[model samples]
Target: MRGAIAAMVLTFLAGSAAAQDLQARLNDYPTEARADYVFGCMAVNGQGRDVLRKCSCSIDVIASLLPYEKYVEAETVLSMQQVGGERMSIFRTAAPAKALVADLRRAQAEAEILCF
Candidate 1:
């Protein structure tokens, strides 16, 4: 029926809009978040340990899937820094987060876990 078709169309449009919003939010995520995402990926991919190869793969995967903005969100939502076993980082990013991403990628590239 026409009513059914209209309802389906409305649902599809709403879903599309929501998907766009999620993408936008992901893009807007902060550098710290991105780091966190990296940590999470490292944790998951490397047998519950931080493995550089796994981390790199995870970052690459994320970079390929996200637009610049979503990548920023991933970076923001995921970024973190551990100093003397204390984790610290900014949790929100209102800017591009590219600098953070670049810095983080470089740090990750060079990092070796001193403990754990």
Candidate 2:
């Protein structure tokens, strides 16, 4: 009986650790960043309550698919690409920058399919 009880306790502890790891991964995206994504999404989609829910879902999908650091890198590359100057041309033409943006776009596409 004692051996069975010990096995059950070990199983419970393992499950708890797994849950904590999952929670940490899910929370990698900061609240402000998530809010920014949802607000931008809502602006393009709509301002209704249902749109809010969808936008929130979209960001959650994105957060699940892409790490925050990669997301930020892609965002920076995109923002830089928007600038009209020789100095900013690298953002438009560089292979690394393109790859970063491509990863972000793929994540967004996945999010769109799943959320909307």
Candidate 3:
């Protein structure tokens, strides 16, 4: 009986640690990046209090779905795609770049469904 109680305590501690780790990962996006996302989302959706809430929720969902590094890679690819140069063509045409963008897009889509 004592062993069972100890095992339960250990299990609960392990679960708490796991939850904290997941929360830290989900919050890996920098404040600036999260703000930028929310602002862009609000601009596209609308500038209102409710829009603010939804936009915040959207970024949170995206952060939960994607890591900060992956998000940055996808954003960089998208920005590079806009430059008018032969070098920029790689971002526009490369499979790897497309895949990064697709991952970000999928996260955003999931965020949309959840938040809006």
Among these predictions, the greatest TM-score belongs to: 3
TM-score of 3: 0.93
Ranking by lDDT: 3, 2, 1
Model 1 C-alpha RMSD to native? 11.6
Q: Which pairs in model 3 have colliding backbones? A: none
Error of 1 at 53 (Å): 5.8
Comparing 1 with 2 on lDDT, the higher-scoring candidate is 2
lDDT of 1 by residue, 1-116 (tens): 99999999999999999999876754554557557767776676564444655664555445434455545444554544322232333433334344556555554444323212
Q: What RMSD, rounded to one decimal, does every model reach?
A: 11.6, 1.7, 1.2
Estimate, for each residue in 1-116, the C-alpha lDDT of model 3 and write its tens digit.
99999999999999999999999999999999999999998889999999999999999999999999999999999999889989789999999999999999999999989999
RMSD to the native, candidate 2? 1.7
Better of 2 and 3 by lDDT: 3
Task: State the lDDT at 74 in candidate 3.
Answer: 98
Q: Which ten residues in a row are the worst by lDDT in model 1?
A: 80-89
- Which one is best on lDDT? 3
**Tens-place lDDT digits, model 2, residues 60-104:** 888888889999999999998989989999999999999999999
Off by over 4 Å in 3: none
Q: For model 3, what is the alpha-carbon lDDT of residue 97?
A: 98
